[model samples]
Target: MKSFRLDELEAERAANDGAYLQFLRERNMSVGLYALDAGESDRQQPHGQDEVYFVVSGRASITVGTETTEVARGGVVYVPAGVPHKFHHISEDLRVLVVFSPPES
Candidate 1:
C-alpha cells in the first residue's frame, strides 16, 4: 500500500485561479486537492469527467445544471459526466477534494 502525508504532497498554484495538488491514482480512478480563490475562474469548459467534490475549506458557488449552490466546508457536490460546470467565489477561497472515475465503467 502507498501512503502520503499532507506535507509530502507538492503544492502547485495555477497562477490565476485555482491551485491543485494531484495526490493519488489507481487502475481506474484518481484524486486531487484543489483550491480556488475569489473572483478567479475564466469560466472554462468542463473536461468531461464525472466528478465528486468534497469541500475541505472556505466557501464557493458552483454552477451545475440549471442552478448554482453555495458550498461551504464539509459539503459535497456531484457533477454529472460531461456536463459543463464552473467554480466561482466572492470572499473565501474554495478548497476541495475531487475524485475522478474510471473511463470505461
Candidate 2:
C-alpha cells in the first residue's frame, strides 16, 4: 500500500517546465498531479495511453479533439489514447489529478 499528500508533493519540484508531479507508478497504471496558475496556458501533448483527469481545484476550459468544455472543481474528464487535449482559459488556480491506464511511456 502507498499514500501521498498533495501539499507535500507540491513542495518537491520534479521538473522546471511546469507544476507536474508524477507520484505513483504501478504495473498497470500511473498517477500524477498537474497544476497551472491563473491565466497560465497548458502545453501538454497527447498521450499514448488512456487518461482520466480529476479536478482538485479551480476552473478552466478543456479542449479535447475539436470540442471544448468548461470544467471546475470536482469535475472529471476522460481522454482516449492519442487524442489531443489541453486546458485553457484558466479562471482560477488549476490543480488536477491525472491517471493513466496501462501505464505511460
Please, what is the whole-model Cα lDDT of each candidate in the order they appear?
0.72, 0.90
Task: Spell out the clash pairs found in candidate 1.
Answer: none
**Which stretches of model 1 miss by more than 4 angstroms?**
7-18, 42-44, 103-105
**Candidate 2 Cα RMSD after full superposition onto the native fold (Å):** 1.7
- Candidate 2 lDDT, 45-96, residue by residue in tens: 9999999999989999999999999999999999999999999999999999
lDDT accuracy of residue 72 in candidate 2? 99
Check candidate 2 and list the clashing pairs: none
RMSD of 1: 3.4
lDDT over C-alpha atoms for residue 15 of model 1: 38
What is the TM-score of candidate 1? 0.78
Best by lDDT: 2
Q: Which residues of candidate 2, in runs, are more than 4 Å off?
A: 14-17
TM-score of each: 0.78, 0.92
Error of 2 at 37 (Å): 0.8
